[model samples]
Target: MNPYLIVPLLALFLNLSLFTYVLALKGKHRVVHLYLLYAGDLSLWIISIVLYWSFLPIHWMPWIFKISSISWLLAGTLFLEFVFAFLSKNPNILLYLLRGLALAIFPITLTTDWIIGGVERKYWGDMLLPGPLYVYGVNVLIVTPAVYAIFLLLYESRKEEIGFRKQCYLLAFGTFLTSILGFLTTILPRILSQGDLHYPPLSGSASVIQSLCVFIAIAKYGFLEIRLEKIALQLYSKLREGVILLSTADELLYWNESAKEILGFSKSSSAPEKLDLGNFLDGFTRKPFTRMDFKKKSESPAKEIRIDDETIYSTGPVYLEVSKSEIPISGRDLGKVYVLRDITEKKEASEKINMLYSRVVRDLDIAREVQNTITTRTFPDSEKFKIFSYFRPYDHVGGDVLNCAESVDGKIEILFADVSGHGISSAMVAAMASISFNVVSRKGSKPKEGLLFTNDLLSSVVTQHFISAMYLRFDPKTLILEYSYAGHHAGLLLRKGETLDLPGKGGVLLAVGTPILEDYQIQLQAGDRILLYSDGLFEVRGSKGIPMGNTTLVEAVKKLSYQDSDGLIRSLVSYSESFGDGIMTDDLTLFCLEISESA
Candidate 1:
C-alpha cells in the first residue's frame, strides 16, 4: 500500500470519531451540525485517497475522484452553517437561496471537468489529473465560504463571552489550512508544469496537523466551558482550605491542592505520604465536625471552621453536594464531589461576637453574687411545720422567693411571692420581698398585718412595681390556719382524698391598690398537706384558651394522695407536664408543707 494511504485513513477515522462524539453529546452540547461538516470532509478525503491509491484501475477512479470534489463544497457550506449557529446569527430565506446557488457551482464543475484535469494513462498510472484552469476554478469555489467562515469566527471572538467562538477559530484555521493545501496538492503541479507544490510539504503537513487538532478537540477539551474538575485543581493550588475529599464510606481520595504546591510537588504529582489525604486529615487532632448538622446535597449558612492556624471559615456548602452520575463507559457509581469554600473573615467576626457575650456574662455573674448576699438563708425553722421547697430559674436570676420565720409567741409565718417579670429586675424585687418578710416577722406582726405592711413598704420603695404573694400563719395550740392573698394565685389544700382551692378574694398586688387582704382560717390535720406555688404552676396556657385552672389542680392533688410533700410536688409537675404536652412557658416554684403532731 502507498505510504500516502495513511493520511486518508487517519482522516477517515478522525472524521468518524468526531461524528460519533457529536452524537454522544447530542442534547448536551448540541453539536450535531459539526458532525455534518466533518462527514462531508471525510467523504472528500476517502474519494481522493481511493482515486490516488488505485490509479492503475482507472475504469472508475476518474469518475469517482471527479464526483468526490463536490463533497468539499458541502463540507465548506456546513462549516459556514455551524459558524452562523455558533454566532447566534439567523439568515433570511433569500440568503439561504444564495448559498444554494453557490453550492450548485461545485456540481456543475465536477460533471463538466471544469473543476478537475482530464483523465490520462501515463507511465506512472491512469491519473485523472488537474488541468491548467483547475486550481483557479477550485479556489474560487472553496475560498469564498472558507474565508467568510474565518471572518465570522474572528468577528465573534471580539464579543464578551466568546470562549467557544475562540475555540472555533482555532478549529477553522486548522481545517482551512488542510483544505487549501489539499486543493493545491491536486492542482498546483498541472498548472505550473515545474514541480508538485502541494503534497509532501504543504498538504501532508497540514493534514497531519488538522487530524491531531480534531482528535484533541473532540476527546479532551470540554464543550468550551471550564469543568469543575479543572477548577478543583486550580483551587487545590491557590486557596488555603485544607480540603480532603472522601468517598461515602469515609475513604480518602484527594487532599490539599494548596499543600502540595507549597511542598514543591508538581501539579501532575500525587500528594506526599506525610500529606496523604487520609493520614493528614486524621492527624488534625481537633474535634471532628458533626455530620448530623450538615445538609445533604445542599448548602449551609456561614459557620466557623478552626483547623489549626489555617482557620478555614466556610461560608458555602462545606461538602460538595454530589449527586450520583453513571459514566457510560463504566457502569458504576462514581463518587460524590465535596466542594468547600473558605470564609475566614466571617468566622473571625463570629468569634469576636462570642467573646463580647462572654464579657457580658461575667458582669452578670458579679451581680448574681451581690444579689445572693442581700437575701440570707438563716430564716428561723418551725417544729410544728415541715417545709419542702423547690426553686428553679430558667435564667440566671429567678422570679420566685419563699420565706418562713418563727414568731416570739410560737406562731409560724410562711410567705411565698412571685415577683413581676424575670431576670435582674425580678431578682431585686425578690430581695426586697425577703427583707420585708424578715423585718415584719421580727416585729411580732400577724400574717395579715405583716403582709399588708410589707406590701405597703415595697409599693413606696421599689421603682417599677408590685408583687403577688400569699402569706400564711399556723398556730399548733389553737389549731387555726390563717392565710391572706395579695393579687396572687390561690393555694391548694389536700386532706384525705379530697382537694380544696383557696381563692384570693382580696387586695391587688403591691404598689397597685390599698394594702387590704382577706384572711381565711382552716382547721388542719396531721396527715394533711398544703402546697403553695407561683402562678407559673397553674396559670399556664392550655388547649382551647383555658388555663390549667382550679379543676385540673383538684385532680392533680387527689392523684398525689399517697405521696409526701416532695413526692407530691414532683407528681404535680409531672402531671402538669402531661397536661401541657411537655412545654412550660413560665417558671414553676412549688413549696410544700406537711402538718405534724405538736411536740
Candidate 2:
C-alpha cells in the first residue's frame, strides 16, 4: 500500500466520522450541523484529489481534477456559511456572490485548462497551479471568506463569556495556524521551492486539522449555544460597580467603564500596561497604599474606600466597598481582580448585611456549645412532671423563647413567647418579654397578672411587630393547670389515647397592649401529656409548599407522646423534615410535658 494512498484513506475515514459525530452532537442547535456539510465536502475533496491526480490514468487526470475540485469549492462555501451563522450574522450578498461565481466557472474549468490546468510533476507527486481563473475561483470565492471568518471569530469572542471567549481565542488561533500551515504547504512551497516539493498534494490534512479544532470548540465548551448576549458588553462596562483586572506586577490589564470613570480616565483613553496605584491612594483615603498599612487597619476584611466627593453617579459621598480576589488559576498570571461596590445607596441594607455576616461568625462559635444558651431546659422541684423542650432559630438569634420559674408559692410558672418575626429585632423583644415576665413573677403575681404586665411592656418597646405568648401556672399537688394565651396557638393535650386541644380564651397579640381575657383551666390526671409549640413547628412547608396544619400536629403528638420529652421532640422534627423533603423554611420550637402516676 502506498503511503500517500493510506493518508488519503485515513483522512476520508476521519472526516466521515467527524460529519456524523458533529451532526449527532448538534445539541438541538443547527449551527454545527451545517458545518458538518463542510466537513463532508472536505472529505470528498480528499478522496477526489487521490483518485484524479494519482490513481487515475493520464488521459482522464486533467478533466477529473476540474470536477473533483467542485467539492473543495463547496467545502469553502459551507465553512463561510458556518462562520456567519455561528456569529449570528446574516450573509446575504458575499455568500451568494461566492456561490454564483463557483457555479458559473464549473463548466468552463472542466472543459478548458483555465482553472486547475495540467499539474507540474514535483518530487513525490503532481502539483496543480492556480490557472487563469484562480483570482475569481480561489481568491474571491474561498481565500477571502476564510480570512473574514478568522476576523469574525475574534470580533465575536470579545462579547462572549470569559471562559468561552478563552475557548474562542484558542479556536481562532488553531484556525489561524491551520491556515498558515495550509498556505505553507500549498502556495508557499510551490513559490519558494518551484517543482522540488509536492506541497499541494499534502494540503488535505490542514482542512482536517481545522475541522478538529472547530469540533473541539463545539463539543467541549458549547461555544455555539453559550455565547453571551452582545448587549452585555455595554451593560458590563456601564455597571455602577467598578471592576479592574490587574497583572501580577500591579499593572492594569483590563478595567470596566465604571473603573475608568471612577479613576478619572476620559472615555477616549486607552488601557495602559502599568496603572499607577499611587494615583489610586487618594481615592482610598482611609488606608495607606502599602499592604502593611492595610494589615494594621483591619485584619480580617478587605477595606472599602469611601468616595465622598460628588462624582458621575451620586450627589452625596458614595461609599464604595472594595473587594479583591485572585483571578482563576492559569499558568500565565492573569493578575488579581478588584471590585468596587456602591454601598451608599442603601445604608440600612448594607449595615444589615454586615451585621448578618458578623452574627453568622459569632453564632457558629456559640452554636458549638449551646448547652446554656437561649433554649436552656429546667424542671420544677416536683417528681410528678417531666418537661423537655427544643428550640432552633433559622439564624443565630431567634424570637422564640422559653423561661421556667419555680415560684415561691406552690406554683410553677412556664412562659413560652414567640415574637411576630425572626432575627435580631424580634429576639430583642423576646428578651424584653422574658425579663418582664421574671419581674412580674417575682412580685408574686398570678400567671394572668404576669402576662398582662408583660403585654404592656411589649407595647411600649416593640414597634411594627407583636408577640404571641402562652403563660401557664401548674400546681403539682392539686394537679391543676391554668393557662392564658395572647394570640397564640392553643396547647395540645394527649389523654386516654386521644388528642385534645386545650382551647383557651385568646386575647390580642402582645405588643398591642390589650388586656388579657379570662384564663382557661384544665385538670391534669395521670398519663396526661401536654405540648406547647411555636407555629413554626406546624407551619413547616411540605414538598408542595403547603403548611402542615394543626390536624397533623395533633396526630403527631398523639402518636409520639409515649417517648421521653427529648425523643418526642426529635421524632416530631424528623417527621416534619420527612414531609418537607429535608428543606427547613422556618424556625422550630417544641415543648413536651408528661405527667407520670408512679412519680
- Best model per lDDT: 2
Q: TM-score of every model?
A: 0.39, 0.40
lDDT of 1: 0.58
lDDT of 1 by residue, 61-174 (tens): 667666766665455556566666655567545337536855776666666765555566543334556555565655554556567777777776553122234356566777
Best by TM-score: 2
lDDT of every predicted structure (CA atoms): 0.58, 0.65
160, model 2: CA deviation in Å?
Answer: 3.6
Q: Residue 212 of candidate 2: its Cα lDDT?
A: 71
Q: Model 1 reaches what TM-score against the true structure?
A: 0.39
User: Number of clashes in every candidate structure?
Assistant: 7, 0
Model 1 clashing-pair count: 7
